[model samples]
Target: MTTEMGNPRSRDIVLIILSNSIQRLTFLPVYHHATVVVMCCLWLQTKQSLFPIALVTNASVHVIMYGYYLLCVMGLLPKWKRLVTDCQIVQFVISFVVSVLMLYYNFTGFGCSGILGRCFNAVFNASLLTLFVNFHSEDYAKKKQG
Candidate 1:
């Protein structure tokens, strides 16, 4: 809670980016990337097996990027947690922990690479979800309502 003096959380920056999405220019990249990926998948289905798989794999990358932004733009994720906790720091800690574990896994290769990598991405990327849950479960939201 002790926000030294002038700095803010990365979630604030992310929220700013989300807010800007209301403008037409800012919204187009998300839409364009999403649509292109989808179209690539559909096109890949025609005659090539590898193309389909590759398309799906690449498209999933965009799915998270654009989808997360879209959710932020829609006000689906709450915004108050940054007032109490440093989201950027928390996310960085989480990422660091996961990265250490992933390095261990890299040496061990103890399980499926695909699944492990995907789990890493999804877990680290749940900052917005965590923010939403924190906002809803905290007293601030209620206080603001009154």
Candidate 2:
């Protein structure tokens, strides 16, 4: 199949369009709501001083990525998909590092909550990183080769 724009309407292209459309219509809004929860939880943690300072620092990275996500969803950035794929690679690296540091800090016999928090952190970051890696390879690597 081929689109009117002369682009091949392959399965990958269809999936990409569907994913972006879903992100624009729903995912981004839900993500913003989740950010509110994160911010509130961070603020509460700040008051308690339970978590290490890295948690606070990591929030800034999330905010930066959220802004980039918003821009991509809004179609304000040209070549936005490529730009976002590149940014996701950076985000994944930073997230993985932060998550590991968080786990390290609490390795000395932390409570169940502490352990679970790090577990969730690792899983979430890893999952997103995998998705982005697959997307990047499918979208760009094949294009370059073919």
Candidate 3:
């Protein structure tokens, strides 16, 4: 049943443990690091098959974001700054959908793990979505108007 549902329990545990340790060593603001650590711990407790999907989506978006910043640093500012924001917004929307699905599956089936963590994740994503939308409106919308 676990294998059929895509929840490779042991592997997910190891991955979350490794990621948590690495995050501890990395230089992030204290609050951000703490938040990530908590999230990682929560994920460690989750048996949800969709956890990896969320992780991959978030990581992919960050890779693109950092790549965009790298281009700007190299004096090659891509004209696709708006695209980066668009991607972030899209990622959040996808995350919300995934969270909803997780909830549905949790109630309808054998239940998912790490639901608490998923709630925290949804709130965090919501805040980021709000901030990014405001940034887009203030930066891009103004340009279009004036």
* Best-performing candidate as measured by TM-score: 3
Of the pair 1 and 3, which is ahead by TM-score? Answer: 3
TM-score of each: 0.25, 0.47, 0.67
lDDT score, residue 31, model 2?
Answer: 43
What CA root-mean-square deviation does each model show from the true structure?
14.4, 11.6, 9.5
Please give, for residues 51-107, the per-residue lDDT of candidate 2 as tens digits.
444344445555565567578668787444566567657766776786676677667
| Residue 78 lDDT, candidate 3, scale 0-100 | 99
lDDT tens digits, residue span 1-146, model 3: 23312433233334446757544332222333345555556666765456788778877877887789689768997999888889978997888777777777778985677788777777766766676677778879888999
Candidate 1 C-alpha lDDT tens digits along 1-146: 12312222223334556767445433323433333343333433433223334335444544454455577668887544343234433443554455455556656866324444434343533543454346445645677788
Clash pairs detected, candidate 1: none
Model 3 lDDT vs. the true structure?
0.67
lDDT of each: 0.43, 0.54, 0.67
Give the range where candidate 2 is weakest over 10 consecutive residues by summed lDDT. Answer: 1-10
Off by over 4 Å in 3: 1-37, 45-48
TM-score of 3: 0.67
List where candidate 1 sits over 4 angstroms from the true fold: 1-81, 115-146
C-alpha positional error of residue 114 in candidate 2 after TM-score superposition, expressed in Å: 4.6
